[model samples]
Target: MDNKTFSLQTDLALYCRTGLYEPQTSIQEHTFHYRRLVYNVIKDTLRRAFPMTRKLIGKRRWKKMVMHFFEYHKCQTPQVWKLPQEFSDYYQQVNFPFKKKFSFLVTLLQYEWLEIEVFMMEDLPIDEFSIEKKSQEDRIIPNPEIKILSTEYPVHLKNGKEITEEDKGQYFVSVHRDFYTKQIQFNDLSYPFVEIILKANEGCFSRKDFIELLAKYDSDREKIMKLYQDFEQFALQNTIFLGYQI
Candidate 1:
């Protein structure tokens, strides 16, 4: 076939596969059969990456949601690995009949996404761990990898069901590598400290200063030191304290 013939055929197949028919073609029978097969594979890939998000909405709604995205969104990356980040952005705009039925469900989906994203999103350069080499007087900036921080706007939940918010609270989440993957988890106090560290604000509170900042909350010196030690251990295990490039 000539170039023009080939181009016209490709365009017609694409348009027909997407449900917008071009002029009727003799080629339709074979191409349309393969089109359904390809589309189903693509949709299933999306569903797997976002299974929790799918379970949040039932199967039928989830399939419709994925189909809408596949039809509308022009995926920018040539690599399929990058698709989940795009899916996450799409996940935010979705509103099912009873979407917020589980108060922390959406947040949990986001949290799970971040855990996987951080571990795989980019490569951290390999480097020697050397925090032990720091002198007692050495002043150090807290490394970014030691902290996973974020804030949710205008909504708060307690016991996973009661939702209300007067103000946004900073969450200081911890991300650490366990075996081959990074894990994200946090307790109430640690979340705020992680947030402060990541903000890296000028005249911002130091990790040591974090204890002082929260002094009024619980003034037991032993407990405060224990918190610091635990976070330090987490940082060390994750290679953040040693300034491993990330």
Candidate 2:
């Protein structure tokens, strides 16, 4: 496209996104209608993506926040569904009045966005591994689509408005899609379990490896064994460990 055509399109997009810089033409009235339609589409998409956030922030402030994001934040994603991820990123970085009051907002955005991410994630290639091999000596393979989120607030358990000073503590959550069912699942975990999953994500780990790793932290054999057993059950039940590598 020519410079003038490109410039015109850019201006229209800005107007649609921010309701600013209306093109000086006879079609200005039509452009206003088009802009409203564009804004509503984005608003609806965001509303669905973050229903809990909207409820906590209230309608008036949420609308203002959306307008602020629309006007100032230059969204990069062409996909409507993925736009919330960008918004989440933007919210975390930008300083907002609500952020001070709602300290857990960023974590909440991440928690909610993860559900969409896990559900829409592409199928991981597990052809090399065999689920039939379940042995302590064999290295366990984790689902490639899994994600672990560590936050200061228990956004997974409570809404933004519901959280208090008592709720401010370390929270670890594992969000993953079920390998067979294709359903998204969330699991609350302790710090040690999070560490184990992080290690597993780095590479395959066998039950023996986890036991040795735990031994480095604690010399008590019984404690290490119990912790390993708990993690083993959690991993297998959630499909965090898809299977043992062949």
Candidate 3:
């Protein structure tokens, strides 16, 4: 397309998003109708993406927030489903009016967006390895489609309105898509366990490595060994650890 046509299209998009531009008298009526349609599409898509956030903030406030995002933020992703992630990013960087009232808003947005992310993420290749043959020396294999989130608010446990000052503390959560079921799952994790999963992601850790890591928190060798065993059992049950890598 020519530069003038491209520029016109770009201006139209900005006008639609911000409701600040007036087109030529000849096309004003059609432009108004098209802008309304565009706004509705964006509003509806964001509403579905952040249902929990909307519930916590009320409809009127949610509408205003959506408008703020539409007007001020230039979204990077073309995919409709990925827009929520962009919105979350925008929420963190921009100073929204409701931010003071809802300090945990960004964390809540992240928590909600991650569920969609895990649900829509593409599948990863699974290597042929037997759980029965797993050994301490074997490097662990973590589920590829997983995310670890750390938040000061228990956004994972409590809704935004329900969260209070008392509930503000360090919290770790593992969000993963089950390998066989393709279902998204959330697991609350302690600090040490969170560390183990993070380290495992860097490069799969062996059982011995897991023990030594846990030993840092507790000096009891026997207790550390037992904890590692328990972790292995839990990881296998939840598909957190897919299997031992060959």
Candidate 4:
């Protein structure tokens, strides 16, 4: 009703959500009900966002971590889907079940979350057929939703199974949401291409350097140039579909 009343009510609701305190009054009981409701909603949102992480950890541990996140983590974004985007950050800051046991936990969370993040992005949506081939020195536009991720584990090959030594190979993964199908796509990008895309996204890494960088990967000039052609072709065909903003 008043400022003090609202503040107390808010605090009480938060406490209930955190499982720190129970409702004391009729209104507080309603607050508790809504608090639990909101907690479950946020939990479900995170569960969808990090399905692989949840699978890796199991329901009990995942629920416990979710509760911990619910109690201690402060969400910066108002959007529900973006809530789990901070889970990895919180996990890193807070030493919990995944403190050191799960080496790929944070990276796996990121790889999984990228699907949701990219799918929700608002991009310019350039068509592949309309995109023109540009020289290596020219700055080429890249898909806005594309995220370049590098990790020791083959996070791209994650199939909900627990991690082992065999999954320890380093990988460069590009996850983007396709404009035509609006489906999330995974591309295992090569060395120079990965570097080029990462820099290109930042408004750097022209086509000339794109080929030059690839050339460094191989001593054979003709083979390296061919790789450049294929790389540029893929970008023009698929990546352009996500369209370029800058």
- All candidates: TM-score: 0.62, 0.90, 0.91, 0.81
Best by lDDT: 3
lDDT of 1 by residue, 124-213 (tens): 443333455344333333434333535452222243333445434555455444322455434333554454445432222335565565
Model 2 lDDT tens row, 74-149: 7788888898898899897788777888878888889999999989988767636776765668888887788889
Per-residue lDDT tens digits for candidate 4, residues 59-118, read 988988988888887677777878877876787788785557777787888888788888
Give every collision pair in model 2.
Answer: none
* Range of the 10 consecutive residues with the lowest summed lDDT in candidate 1: 153-162
lDDT for predicted candidate 2 compared with the true structure: 0.84
Model 3: weakest 10-residue lDDT segment is 127-136
lDDT of 4: 0.73
Error of 3 at 198 (Å): 1.7
Better of 2 and 4 by lDDT: 2
Alpha-carbon RMSD of each model: 5.9, 2.1, 2.1, 3.7
